[model samples]
Target chain A: MSYLELSNVKKSFGTTIAVDDFNLSIAQGEFVSFLGPSGCGKTTTLRMVAGFELPTSGQISLQDKNLTYLPPNKRNVGMVFQSYALFPNMTVADNIGYGLKVTGKPKKETNARIKEMLGLIHMEEQHNKFPSQLSGGQQQRVALARALAIRPQVLLLDEPLSALDAKIRLELRLEIRRIQQQLGITTIYVTHDQEEALSLSDRIVVMSKGKMEQVGTPAQIYTSPETEFVANFVGQINLLPVKVVSPTQGKVKVGEQILQAGKFGHLNGNPIRLAVRPEELNHGFIEGANNLSGKVEAISYLGSIVRIRLDVEGNPISMDVFNERKLTIPSVGDDYQVTFPVEACWII
Target chain B: MKTKRINFWAFFWVVLAFLYFFLPMYGTLDFSLRMKKGVLSLLAYQKVLADPQFLASFRYSAIMGVITVIFSILLFVPTVYWIHLKMRQLRPLVEIITILPFIIPVIVYVFGLIRTFSGPPFQLTLTPFKTDILMVAGYIVLAMPYMFRAIDVGMQTIDVRTLTEAAQSLGANWAQILFNVIFPNLRTAILSGALISFALVIGELILGDFLARPALGPYMVEVGRDMAYQPAALAIMSYALTWICLGLITLFSRSNNNQRQILGR
Candidate 1:
């Protein structure tokens, strides 16, 4: 059995379903992130695993033990909230040692654990200071250390970096990744930010509404999204409605252009949708590749890369080009041909 | 010239407010001092302090204040915390119910309490002790608005739900979440509320007068009608007591604010 497994978990409040038939198994010492927009049941699923919320239906087990009926305190799962929910009355050391003290660990051992946590979070100087005396980043570190102090069976983080500045968010994101790797604790992270999920988790579960859209590794999820929602939600994808003319040859018709794709998993003459990422498009034509001409509708000058929105036979396409010293940016109203490799086009 | 004018106006309001509140206190202090003879004396204070009736009434009122504070904390802390957690939909209703004391007149409420609790169904007003219990109940109801607001605001300042979850995740049961987590964090807010509740109970006269209790409020009124100097002394003492409560509130909040500033929002 996996370290933590959730089977067909469903949650409903009145008529609104918060989570529906969500199933996932996390291996021991694995870091999995439940990634989606707000109200996508990602947080709800994490809470269920933490035993804060009971699954309205389905089973949850941690290390072959049934945890579905267990309360949060009994489940031995540590959670860090989006808001650093450190006890304001307790000093930094006390906040970190709270779990040990509450679990009736000896005072001496609790003190030693608190010292270790302080060293782990690199906040030994802040042990005597209260949570209210620490900065946002510092408080979150203390909060992180507090969660990790208990040495829980699973560490659940609910958007722990969402309540920070962009720079601090990035810095803490790397710090959390480092800590998770060092601890090798089975961690379930919930986040709305795709970049944070992509840059962190060993595997990402993309959710929408109340259903799991896709669950895969970061590379698999980004490269080959199973659902259109997952493809669009994970990253930028240029979706084109195409008519599949030949499923055997992987040929599809995009308006007036006939393009050969490598993923035409459909019947002949069926209207299917194809997704191509902006980064996959190469400027100028290449031999034996799908070359389509379009008029540049707009050009966005991002640092180090330029994004060009092109109108391809009335179909809008977004293309990204890295700024090469030898290459010039395509302007609006300029005619350009972009090459998309057959393998790069994903049929959704 | 502008700085001079600003300081002048500042000093003007300072003097005006000092006299506005201080004049009555000064007159009462002077009258209390003139009890023995031409010389200023502590004779009235000594008399009031020594009297058994004064001692009993003051002790009764102090006990009532403590009971009211305890009752307020026990009743509202969990009530407000629960409303914030599971029954958030009923928060507005709870808030409106708390403010009903402010809407109803105190005299009418006291009479209503007497009518409800004095009959055969309860007959709580028959015994002096029963009436004392009624007094504490009445005080809790009267102080509900302030108490609930204090606790609700405290709950708002922290992520109460998340904090509760964190505590639970750390192996804390419900009782630990209450005493160790929620209650400790809300210490200052609860203290502020208890102080307000204490001041209200000690200073309240309407309930004491009608409920036929031997509390400090009725004792002061009895002293006021019979004596010339002792009433002023009692008045000054009560004023000082209220001032002490207010001073404690300011001190607690200032310290809380100082720590919060270092933590930052």
Candidate 2:
């Protein structure tokens, strides 16, 4: 059974619709991520679930209780903001114990919880320090501790790691995941970073322009993107136009090449976007592989992966080939041949 | 060559400004000290400090300053917060209203206040307490610009909406959000605003003069006509009081030092 559900949720500000007809059901203790670019409705959906934004028309329920128009105070939801909204006036301990104190928790319980949270975040020595005295990552951890002190039913994190340095962001991301897993709390993380979403989420909801484009597991989202937008937004993808020549045998025509591809299961004899990842294509053809020949236009050496942009009959195709000890790097303006299996081509 | 020219200009202004501000103060101190014709004496300071009128007027203005500060806080803090959090479209209108005191001259505004409340159905000036209330209202209007700007800037520095939401989500009601969360965070801002209002109310001459109130401003002017050294003494005392206010603000901000402090090292 779903622990939290948003049904037909819609939010509009003046004439601008921020979230339109959003529908989803999250199981208990599930780690779900709303992944989208700026101006998408992912943050809005998270805000709605947290009772920060009242949906124009929808039903949001936790278990059996309806929380459609509940104010944030009665929602029992905890949130960590991007700016780490820790109370500057309070010390780290006071900030973490704030929720407990306000909710009339006993002093002994609040003190014990604050101690536990400090130990969890590994900042016990810095309990008396102010937020301005700590680093940005430390401040955000205190913010998370404060949110979790209330023992909320749902945890909402809105781009919580976006404000940190790259190294600290990675470390804190792992820490947050560890904490969430240990607590077994239902969490909704919102971010535009695809790698962050893909690595951290049990299920990912890709959104665009106030609408959900696709919702699936990370592996499914990466390998079998249902729409063109999800395929492009999630990772680097090469989209080439192709025409279905035979519907029965899953045959497609790609620029003077007849390739046996996956079944479209839809319309035939119409041009569609054929999606393929850069790493899917190799530098040489093995047995029973479809091949493409092109002139390399640009070469970017990215330490582990050598990205070569190839111009194949006026269409640019980006291919990432791993750099092994024995393999020679490709140069620009060189004619190269790369191939992928027929099943790797995804028609969207 | 460019460095020399910039240094010359900067040095010129520093010296020019020093003379412009320091000369009159130096002259006043010299005249006030020469009470025994040739020798420097503390007779003027002694006379001013012992006078009954000085003590009454000073105490009255001090009380008036406190009243104005309270009135401004009660009036502007919620108004500014409401306009910021919910009534966002009214922000521009509210800003213009806050700056209205700065746009209209103080003497002109006092005249309007007198004309509006002097006669007819509401003759506030006839009763002493009513006229004192009117004086407090005038002081609030004059202090609106500084107080509102201070508070609005404070709200902007922190994410007011996000903080409010965070507090509300933590089971805090509106009163808790205001008192426990926002009011504590806005201590420096409130202190700064209160100090500025206090300074303005105690030093103001036009309102007290026109309203026929025995505040410090008119008492100073009244003393200037009969006494020479005593007026200079009062000037020095007022200058010291302003410094004391500035000193308090610096002390408070240093304690609340998330931002860089400006005074009282």
Specify the highest-DockQ model's number: 1
List model 1 lDDT by residue over B214-252, tens digit each. 889989999999999999999999999988998998888
What TM-score does each prediction get for chain A alone? 0.97, 0.97
Q: Write the per-residue lDDT of candidate 2 for residues A209-290, one digit (tens) a residue.
A: 9999999999999999988899999999998777777777777777886666653666454786577899998888666677
Candidate 1, residues A1-348: lDDT per residue as tens digits? 488999999999889999999889999999999999999999999989888888899999988899998999998899998888888888999999999999999999999999998888888887999877778999899999999999999999998888788898899999998998998988999999999889898999999998999999999999989888999998899998888777888778887788888675654446787789999998888888888898999988898888899998888999988887987876789999999898899677
Q: Model 2: residues >4 Å from true position, as ranges? A: B118-123, B259-265
Summing lDDT over every window of 10 consecutive residues in candidate 2 chain A, give the lowest-scoring window.
A260-269
What local lDDT score does residue A175 receive in model 2, on the 0 to 100 scale?
95
TM-scores for the candidates: 0.93, 0.95
Cα lDDT tens digits for candidate 2, B145-245: 99999888877766678778888878888888888878787888899999989998889999999999999999999999998899998888888888899
Give candidate 2's root-mean-square deviation (CA, Å): 2.9
DockQ of each: 0.55, 0.42
